[model samples]
Target: MRGLFIIGRTTAQSIPTMLGIIVISFILLHLMPGDAVDAIVGMSGSASKETVAQLRETYGLDQSLPMQFWNYLSGVFQLNLGTSISYSAPVLDVILERLPATLTLMLCAFVLALAGGIVIGWAMAVFAGRWPDRLLTAGSLLLYSAPNFWVGLMIIVLFSAKLQWFPSSGDESIGAGLTGWAWFLDRAHHLVLPSCALAAFFVAIYARLTRAAMLEVLRQDYIRTARAKGLHPMLIQFRHGLRNALIPVTTVAGLHLGNLLGGAVVVETVFNWPGLGRLTMNALAARDTQVLLGILLLSSVAVILTNLLIDWLVTWLDPRIRS
Candidate 1:
């Protein structure tokens, strides 16, 4: 609201927030039933105590908890997210490799959800108390209450298993030598089911929120005044009402946008898309602490950035925010 200074202040707060997440993730992660060395040994069936001790020392597991945390913090400052015990790669590299797929999926889902919600919400508000409003409310409520994983599964069953319209799993079809626009189209083809699955719940939420906001705005003195002045209904609704309604919508968008990333874990798992969600799953299974911490940190950063972006946008849209 205060412009660059406010945004900068908020951005600075991210350091401590990220540090807290890192600390918590490091501590709780170590408390898990088995260590990375144990996971490695389990894979090979057996190992000598000497070999185990070496692995422990190698990973700095032998150090005191405070020391280990200090070292990890130092590495974090240097952009070293430590190493993945299972992947035998830097944590950042592993996450970055899979990041694009997750980003693409979330971005697509968010745009679709935001656009659909705005349109359906405005329509519902315009036809408030009528059959069209009732129908939209009923449908949106159903979607909002439904579990996304179940929705994703059903979508797959209907669209892929039955209709053969989309592949049920994976980011892309294997061995298809498509290039350029065709290549993008191929990726988009694989993206539809998962993105829709992720977006469905968000669309419902946005629609309900938008409808409520607009209806409230429509009841305000200014809106009534505009109507009394002989303004065109469409122009008043769109330019006057909708614009004011959007401030609250922007708040909701900022708060929940990061949720799309979290939701991607489930949808990605359901659809087998290579993204941070699936990577988180695999890291958890393997007790890959570095990768797990990296992902959690990245997720926290994303949420913070989203909130900052929304703050700027809301200020631009409503001067009251600048106060």
Candidate 2:
């Protein structure tokens, strides 16, 4: 019952938050300088006023702001994100087509970061005040602060250009179809560079957070009592301290998951990957309002859902949170 109540409250809060985001996004998009029609038509000097007006009418851009908002809201409820001005396909269709590639890349990167982070963090905690901990801490800080684009460029220079170990761009081989182990292996090979680029920042963050949390837990009365009872160091750390440290890591990881979905824009663009981030970038350049709005809505929903899942997990992991 307590858990259900927390969920209910969270849902209620999220409703207003999503609505606020929509309103702010719409206004900010509209307030940006330059005419959307002019952008679509290439130039005002070449296009006549009549042609521009027609384009505006075609996209319902001439409608009152309130009416436009109402229409968009209604379409969202009906799962009709409308047709993209640039692509001529439904916005949802465009999003669905590009989503899988992004998800696959993100999932692989997330798994790598999560596993690597926990192990490194655990080692640091166990070897606290030792050279290993100091080395990892220093290395993580350097990687965390380095620009992602620069790291990507270095990876390409070494692996793709210098060694010729991996392809420099695109998600898959030209001849590899979207099936079979051969195709899968090719895709995974391409994934290596981009995933590593994405995981570097996450690795630093998770290691730091986990180390801090574990250090705190290790000083707790229970940990001290366990050590006093002559429990093995590995057992005491793994069986007791690790679970408590996970609570903070869980929160950070959950928030970063949502951020990764949207924040992959730079990484995706750098790699020339044809994911939603790239698609959205193209749509923005073309002033394709439908596609832009569709991507924004999808990202917003993903963030909300990820956070909600984390909330539920917190309740499950620590019953006190339900209270």
Best by TM-score: 1
lDDT of 1 by residue, 199-268 (tens): 9999998898899999999999999999999999999999999998888888898888668888998999
Please list the residue runs of candidate 2 whose C-alpha ends up more than 4 Å from where it truly belongs after superposition: 43-45
**Residue-wise C-alpha lDDT for candidate 2, range 1-323, written one tens digit per residue:** 76687779988988888888777777777776654676877844577789989999988989998898889889988989888877778889989999998998788888888888888898888888999999999988987998777878899999999999999889998875668888888888899998888788898889888899999999999999999999998899988888889898988898897668665677799899889879978887877776777788888888888888988877677767755
Clashes of 1: 0
- Residue 63 shift from truth in candidate 2, angstroms: 2.0
lDDT score, candidate 1: 0.90
| Sliding window of 10 residues with minimal summed lDDT for model 1 | 1-10
TM-score of 2: 0.94
TM-scores for every candidate against the unseen true structure: 0.96, 0.94
lDDT at residue 6 of model 1 (Cα atoms): 87
Cα deviation of 236 in candidate 1 (Å)? 1.2
Off by over 4 Å in 1: none
